[model samples]
Target chain A: MGKHVITMLPGEGTGPEICEAVRRIIDHTGVEIVWEYEEIGLDCLDKYGTLLPEKTIKSIAKNKLAIKGPTTTPIGTGHKSANVTLRKMFDLYANVRPAKLIPVLKRPWDKIDILTFRENTEDSYAAIEHMVSDEVAQCLKVITWPGSYRIADFAFKWAKANGRKKIQCVHKANIMKMTDGLFLEAFREAAKKYPEIEYGDIIVDNCSMQLVRNPGQFDCLVLPNLYGDILSDLCAGLVGGLGFAPGANIGDNCAIFEAVHGSAPKYAGMKKVNPSAVLLSGVMMLRWIGENAAADKIENGMNKVLAEGKTLTYDAGGTASTDEYADAIIKAMN
Target chain B: MLTKATTGRAKRPAKPITLVGVDVYIITENGIPAFDDYGAFKIEFVSNRGTKVWPGYVSEDLMLVNWYRCRFMATKAVTDADVDSFLTQLSKKWKWSAAQKLWNYGDEAGFSKAY
Candidate 1:
């Protein structure tokens, strides 16, 4: 059995708690993974004077695989998101967020499965704001041909491989004619190559309305950076919430799987927050590494635990602690 | 040796800092058009990535940067809302990436390198 070395980033707040829970559950899979732990986010900021340490980045760069917990991005100012920094550092242009309905959870919509492919590198996220004067400011929204094409290509390839039938390109090209227009054009170009898959375009506003109205109609969605950031959260609402959302940032050389939810600072060290998001992210990591059997087993274990409604954390409407929840899933796996 | 008289111009309150024009960078496939009247405003000149490429330009082999900056000058001083309206109208036909407002500082231009 070959041991797979993966960089583990226990971020901030409840990040460590959930990551520990996920680590224990994954260990039971007998997958022989060597977890290289790295400290990041606020803790790293305190120790190293930077949120994202150079050493941590080098570890992930060397290992090529990382599973991370939620990190805090201070409101108003302090520092930019460490996640965004990492994404830009590795050129992780494709942000894949999968939102699937848990059968046990009672939600407004049912059978909602959506895979959001967000172009993560550019757009307003480039952080190029300039104060033109005392009364005005501007931020450059960069949308390159290469950036657009690669993300669209990744979406189509992933959709085809995952047995998805349709790919929807969501944008506000009607208003942001150039930046978003380039994105739509690239999507159309990529669609032509994947002739087997049905392709369509929708304005970002209408896409939001349609998502909430009939999420099932969308099989797979590919969008620019800003729209993807917004719609992925909206799609997460369709299934359950961010607590169950699993995200993966993938580039050519490295991939990092993470929980879409933020670090619940108030619940830090309480052992009460739900670990479903990070746990499912670990499942995604398993699949990414070709451990289909282990992935399926862990996924099935999660489904069983949720369906039983016996052992669950506070967010899931149960009294069990994070470790207890992981214990239940590990026990159920056997 | 042209020395202009600064009699009444020196007493004026620096023209109150008015918006004279705006440079709208539109992403076009075929580069900037040679003659775009814009109806209300004048299309002074067009440039590809800061190098003037249209309206009696220098080099014959001009490289298109996808982003073409078209300087549109108004007949009179315009407000911020007027600039917004102008951009809104232009967006219907051309895909614009960015717009920078050009100001007239008394006699000289506020933004450097007019063309």
Candidate 2:
């Protein structure tokens, strides 16, 4: 097969180094790939004058596939998040994150596999806020039928394809009946199509408690933006941390694979942060592009490396640098 | 706990304020690009969730929903009868979700630009 040309956005802080490590690891897998580098986030603001350069947007629009390292969104008032902008621009409605138990992280649960499908574009993330009065502030919680149905359908379809059984819609419909109610209603409507898949709904708070109590009970949980944002991390905590979780933003036309964690600025030039998240994200991207054999190889290799615990990054309680850890996985692959 | 003796209020300036335009929000899957003038009111442009998306080379990459806000400005001083007539004609073809009147306090606009 000819080389797959994919747009690579090496984001701010520790993004570039970890992306480089992931690239090296993927290269070792013998999957032919041509990387097209793109810029996004604050680091590129000086040169591009915009967080998301137009060229980068054009590249993603053309390629239809991208792998991004963690990008930093500054706290408080600033530009709108480039990540949010990309998702909205491309209509990447489904944020799929798989947080499964990695055997190495000896948590209490022997088997905890949870797939989170987050509605990427709607809810409070819409950035629709205005001061209704001098004291009272209002943020419009926009939820539409089309947006809800598409994400719910995506979740159900994804679960069915991936051999998952149960799918749950998590929401806070008891309180905000109209907004969250619309979400749950859409999930129910979508659920009717896939009768083979057992579907149900749970309130967000109870779902959180259920997750921490016994995560093994759930297979896949589809949630609105706010709940999913909170629960996806909780799901990550079950496995190990953000380092073990890999995420992807998928739409009808485009898909962007990325690490769910943020870029740790303190570890930028240190070569000390873990590359597992981005590497695993690369594995997901490989599977997405039909390079399943290479994906399996890298995944198995990483699993072996994690199992051995001989060479691991500091986050995993070892002294190995990022390059050394990646090299270990690369060596294990062969 | 400390509390203010009285709540502050904003008072209108002594300068004259007049109605200049109206933003009519319509719910539609595909946005309406142009509409004819109703009496003295002329359709300026249409925006979706505050981003301008019509009357020129607008990128198809914008994520569109059902909400579209259309701005219509008056060539002369618009009265309540003018708004009623325009909406009456507008209702014949399209259904409007909401409408907000634009005002000019002296030289400054009461509302922000669509862009």
> Model 1, A254-298: lDDT tens per residue?
899999999989999999989999988899889888998999999
Residue pairs in collision within model 2? none
- Candidate 2 residue A312 Cα shift, in angstroms, is 0.9
Q: lDDT (0-100) at residue B83 of candidate 1?
A: 85
How do the predictions measure up, each by TM-score? 0.76, 0.85
Count the clashes in each prediction: 0, 0
Candidate DockQ scores, in order: 0.03, 0.16
* Residue pairs with backbone overlap in model 1: none
Q: Candidate 1 lDDT, tens digit per residue, B16-77?
A: 46678887878878755554455556888775434456664233323324766678888665
lDDT tens digits, residue span A1-334, model 2: 6789899998989999999999999998888888999999998789988898989988998898999999888676567678887887776889999998886777999788899999887787765544333334455577777789989999999888889999999999999999999998988999999999999999999999988998999999999988999999999998999987899999888899999899999889999999999888898899888899999999999989989999989888889999999999999999
Candidate 2 chain B has its poorest 10 consecutive residues by lDDT at B55-64
Error (Å) of candidate 2 at residue A249 is 0.2
lDDT of 1: 0.82
